[model samples]
Target: MFKTAKKLFTSLKFNYFSLFIISLVAIGLFSFMYDSVKQETYELHEFKISPKTIRSLKTIEDTVKTEQEKRRIENEVTPFYQFDEEVSKTRQAIAASLFDFIIEEKKANIPDPENPDKLVKSRSEQIEEVRNKFKKLEKEEPGLRLTDEAIASLLTAEVSDLTKMKQEIVSIIGEELSKPVRSEDLSAVRYEVERKLRSSEAVPPAELQTMITLGRSLVVETETINKELTDKRIEEEKNAVEPTRILQGQVIVREGQFIDSEIYRQLELTGLLTNQSSYKPMIGLILYVLFVSAIIYLHFATWRTDNYQKKKSLLIAIAVFFILVIIMKLLSLIDKEFDVQVAFLFPTALAPLLVKLLLNERLAYMMTIVTAATAGIMLLEGFSAIMQMEIALYILFGGVISIYLLGNNGRRSNILRTSLVVSVSNILFVAFYLQMTQSTYDLSELSFYLIAAFASGILSGALTIGLMPFFESFFGILSDMRLIELSNPNHPLLKKVLTETPGTYHHSVMVANLADAACESVGANGLLARVGSYYHDIGKTVRPNFFIENQHGNLNPHDELPPEKSRDIIIAHATDGAELLTKHKMPREIIDIARQHHGTSFLKFFFVKAKELGQDVIEDDFRYPGPKPQTKEIAIISIADSVEAAVRTIKEPTPDKIAKLVNSIITSKLNDGQFDECELSMKELRKVERVICETLNGFYHSRIEYPE
Candidate 1:
């Protein structure tokens, strides 16, 4: 029944149709991921504010509030300050110049008492001349003069007191103007100078008042605001505000709560508010599925395997992919309905494990990529985009690690060990991801992730162990596990051969060794060839005395029988072994090896006997029935079987004799057209010959004769 099913699956037409159906199912499922049902719409008046506060359902940026808060923080920032050294120095210089002009004018206006002819100007005229000079200086340089009160006070001062006041006022003004002064603080600075001067008794009361007035006018504003610095400070503060995060399953709008503009926008961002424009998401999803399906098709089309095996592999890949997708979707639904983190416990490595065991490792890695991508899309609900991406990467890394640990061929114990490696990889990936995202390291949450990682590995191993036999039996696949099981010495057929015909059993073991080496040399399934060679002679168990290998003490049961009967007995083992293997439900490849190893070659020994006896016998009457070897492994086994039997006939085999015998046997088999059905190349055949010759020569090498 499985044979018929396998044949149907491997057929060209069925492969194409199945691929199409799988692609369609994938497209439908991916599209359903984003197909949102129309949400219930309510009018503004229908909304009522609830007494209890409501929270956001999804993590969405509140653009309106975020921008508003940023702007408010920016407005509250104080402007920057810039020191104006040039302005301060200019003000000090102008004050010093005004003092110098006053002192010089006081000296110049002194009456010339020594000379009666010299006309002396009146004090008022001199004061008027000094005031005109000050006015001219003010017109030359703006912001250089004192106030009206300060000028009036300086003009009425005594000459000696005025000169002393000029030095004191200029020194005080320079000291005050040296510091940064804002426009708003100018009056306060002036008052501070007046108070300082009033407390000083070094100058007369009139001079002190004049010094205070001049100091007030000299204290001009020098500091200005720096807009660039203020703006930079505001930007840094705005960036420091934590982005609002709405936990998964949080309530966006509670029952009977008013749907404000903010709530409405949240609903829209979360995909809860649907409109006619929603079909765009579905269209995008379909395109994505189509692209992935194309990749799958290209991988299968380019795979370097037989057409039948390619179809079988494709079917298995599609089945595994859909199984993973279904599991992911179910887990997502559970997470959504129960608000649990079951999705984290998903065994993403399960698909890769199955592929690695039942198929090739390359296919396993490829399927892992496809499964991870599909899972990321399917489990996007209730997860932030970043979380979904992390989950996908986590799945990819886990699958890769599992495949790497499984290696070329895995055993049951290897599966357990691989699980441990996968678990460690998963834990490391999760830890790295959390650390990179800067999430709070809650011990409970971390423990949960650790548990999930361990569970993923254990579950992957369990699922692979449980599903491997079914795939092997259903698909007629001879996986390495199955071959290993068959290669055990305690297998029923192998044990039967061991007990009933020890010599033939020994011969089969030798053939297995030879076939294994030869097949390995040519890059064939060496394990399968070894296992197949073990049971290739099981039919000899039925009549151990009829074959030469089981003939002990020179006893030959075929001597009493006719030549034709002896030939019948010899050839019957091939067909009889095939029947027994089939009855025991052995793999077809092993049965074919037992059936076709001889490949209808003429039994020349018996035929020569009949011809020497003057009896007319046809060549066809003494040939073994055969369908010929059908694969590289089977072909190698067939050649190795004949080579082992031929080498055993040499009583004292030498290296040159063994080489000649091996070469002659291979040449005869080639001329007999035994390997026409298989894909064994001429180059591979030469390598097989060399390896078999080397192994046999070493096995049957001359030993040192011991003195008895």
Candidate 2:
């Protein structure tokens, strides 16, 4: 009655949605109690500049730009102004000019009151009034005074013409000034000197107007250039800083520094915060909420991960998930205190094991993604890049162990072996990764880590083993052990099949051996193949005498019946097997194997024999309703079926005769379209033939003793 109730409840009303909502709420409530006001915070708004600061920066940019344009203009028309280099040249030119001045005048014998080198040097620096500087005479210094006798003593008849010399110097200056500045050359000048010149200019309004005109043009062109540069700079700044804000600013988080609704309302009223541009912790809040939502999504999502149940298995997933994330979070907070590396080894090894236990090996592999995400975030947060490799190796180690241990069968010994392998695998992986990354790890610490990996494997295996019974009972999983138990001769159904249809039961055993041998030869699941063979004819137990094999030669019932009725009776076993397997909670794959064993092939000999005996015949009526043999095991069983029945028909068989019969039967099965769906290669078929021949010879051996 409890079984009926369980079945009824499972079949009628399993509310997955309600279960998901409840699971999430429970997880959330539990997590909320432990979660503090502060969690992991990502800074997005903190780097943001205020509007006033932005405007000040714009003003500064304009001033700098205007200064740059004036400088460019100064440099453009003249193409001859720089900082220290120009000053150095000015000093050298003044020295050279003084030598020229002395040579031209021949005033070496006479003691000049002033050194013309100092005068010319000072005058050359008069960038604002170069014309006026040379026209002035200094009276402030006593050094400028000269006696008439002394001035006359400086004169010489060998004097060069000062007028001609001055003319030559002026010509050189004109020649230098006549050269036009290239556009690119004018755009390169020191900004400070130009600013100083602009501030100190005294007269020459016309010259100032011309300079202003040039400055305006340069300002227009440079404004465009500066704007391009500013845009580019903004992009470069964005690229360098790499601004990213996630979660779409839509979700409301229950944790962290959230702006109170009351505070936001007041700020909105005062226009201190706008809806779009206001910094209200929205980005960070939404991102946290998204992270939380994704956690819930991964936990509650009804993903059909192979054998795992959605409604019941969610809680285990949620527990493991939070344990991983929370451990990561806690480790991040206290890493320095604990002296842990970027990530601890426990979680990486634990993730795949947990997935393998609660779900499938495929999902166990899928755990690598979550681990990678976890490692990626840690790397971004400041862990060594080497942590990623360690995490990857740990994930792969766990996956390999889980797949090797839990892929086909979950046994305690396999689990132990898996633990051993995981221990060794983790140690090897760590060794290689550390050597490559040049990490310093103590051997004692590594041994402890491997022990932890081994323990995790055992724990995951235990969990999987413990939970499997419930899932198999609940979701009707047909494990090989269950099938094997069901196929025992003592089973109620098998016993019924044996006593009620002894001939069919005997036939099924032979079929099981043949099918198992065929499957093993081709590297298929031999156990499933064997179990499927036993139950493939369970329907024969329903109506034993209807089948020829179970009739025990009691004046053939089909002899009096129409060919259609007889063929129906024969073809009915396949359909009957399907219904029984389904009703008894066998897996769909086994049901398919049973249903497709016969395929849509005609009952050739029986139909032809009936027709030759003068009965009206329809070819379609004699055919078995089928989906055909979809798997190698089923197709192999079909060929074995024909072989066993045909071999049984041979009244007196010898070893040599049996070999010929077995080869003939296999050839007929191949030619009769029985081998099409199996993907059976020629090599495998030959192997099957050899085994069947050997088995058949042993079963029918009667050798002469004189030969030996």
Candidate 3:
């Protein structure tokens, strides 16, 4: 079962990106199709029955023939189809009859003087008046060449012979019932008459009523026909198709159902589809994963070691980056009234954030690129071309600065501040992008986006915080937490070891100096060795007087005991040291140095004299635990232990004697295989032995007057 599950996970790993790509394409297709139908919702699908199928369908249904599918050529398609024709016909008929009504509608909707008929109507009046005056002029001048001035001159004198005119005229007009006006002044009189005709308030009378009736019929009939056609397709389908004739199926829509070139453009306005996203996601996923992995691969490649720790960190980083992307996915799944392209900003902006805290800046740079590409390809609505490019640029610019300025040396707020600054910078870039694409967007909207970015920044800070401890502990990574705790200057064991047994503490300090120098020169971690030395003999503090160095004013415990008893006391220190360190909860590395520093070295003087006395002394009882020093510090402490003690035994220790003594101690420790488990090579050990010799020689060189 386990094997099967492993194989399943491996398969999921191989083509997970394919699933993502397919899903994105499906969403694009569905959204475009749904939006197209919704926005142009006012239009209806028309179904015209073919002449052949109409009668057959009607005959089958036992009803009159009204409709069938595709019944005629589209020339027969109706007036919303024929809306232009209807408009033209209405324009013509209205001009002949309800001219005033048509003029009002024209004034309301269309641009300046759209109907040419109005101009034609007004011109007709002037044409009729000129012809009438010219005819009268022809009677007077006998030539068709009579000027309009002469025609106008003949006509106005004719109106004065009316009784109505005489009533308005002065009493002097009563002499001939009307006095004739001057013939040359007829132009002014004729203008006044024509002005009254054009501005007349009386409505058009009964003779033009048919034209009004026809115009009204055109509007009403067209509306009725359009409604019929608009509804015909669904109605006919409902009536004609029997349930048994149809296929049983789910509501599956196909690809080209949405991508019709005829209406793709108009469909996009409703927020459905894009021309771009069909295969972009697959491309993006490949690039994103590769880009992120490349960062991990480079850092580890810098070191020659192909160790699991480096590979494990790489795995963790990629997992974290991908997990953040998934979180963004879930966030986008939330319903909002608008497209939050900047929700994408959270993930893009947060990538560097996670990388900076969890990994390094070089990795952060690569991950930022991944973030930008993924967001641009996935989260965005696929309209603006430069969103990915701009976001990427901003992330690099701001994120690199954040890593540089935020050294690995401050409080967590350094990361927080870096996130805040990166988010702000990214928001600014987003705002500029919004302006470039949609030039008329409100500036206040940018304020809201910036605010959102700040919120994301806070979230990024929080996420980095939340994940830090988990990453450190799960990976067993030695990070700032470990460093900070170690640097506390008040670790309990350190304090107790210092206060109770300052002599052993001072010895441990000198050993740390010797070990640190040798460790560093050979390319090992020196600080680790130094810190280890400070606490290596902390067990000696528990029984301070039992050890030689801490027995300042006390008598030697071993002086009165037999040589065998002295050997037992001497061998007991390693075990007692282990016990004391274990009780104090010191690290195992220190405990190992305490217990194994003596290795199986016997009580040399006691074992020799016991043999002379013909007494039986078990050698194993005198030996320390067998697994000796596993590192240079451990082995160095082992040798330093005997060297420090043996040097003190010689009262007049000269430089030559100190060197001889240190060399002999190191050489004896080496020949005994006491340094076998340690990583210290012979060459390095030889150097350590020399350093110990030199350091002790300097201490004893000027103090030669002292004697045992």
Global lDDT scores for all candidate models: 0.77, 0.54, 0.52
Q: 2 or 3: which has the higher lDDT?
A: 2
**RMSD to the native, candidate 1?**
7.7
* Ranking, lDDT, top scorer first: 1, 2, 3
Compared with the true structure, model 2 gives a TM-score of 0.53
lDDT (Cα, tens digit) per residue for candidate 2, span 439-497? 67787766655565555455545554555555556555555545656667787767777
Model 3's lDDT to the true fold? 0.52
Q: How far in Å is the alpha carbon of 455 misplaced in model 2?
A: 1.1
lDDT of 1 by residue, 546-567 (tens): 9888888977877787788899
Q: Which pairs of residues collide in model 3?
A: 49-68, 49-69, 49-71, 50-71, 79-82, 79-83
* RMSD (CA, angstroms), candidate 3: 21.8
Candidate 3 similarity to native, TM-score: 0.44
Model 3 regions lying over 4 Å from their true place = 1-261, 265-484, 487-489, 560-606, 609-621, 632-664, 686-708
Q: What lDDT does candidate 1 reach at residue 384? A: 53
TM-score for each candidate, following the candidate numbering: 0.67, 0.53, 0.44
Clashes of each: 0, 2, 6
Assess the local accuracy of residue 160 in candidate 1 as a C-alpha lDDT between 0 and 100: 75
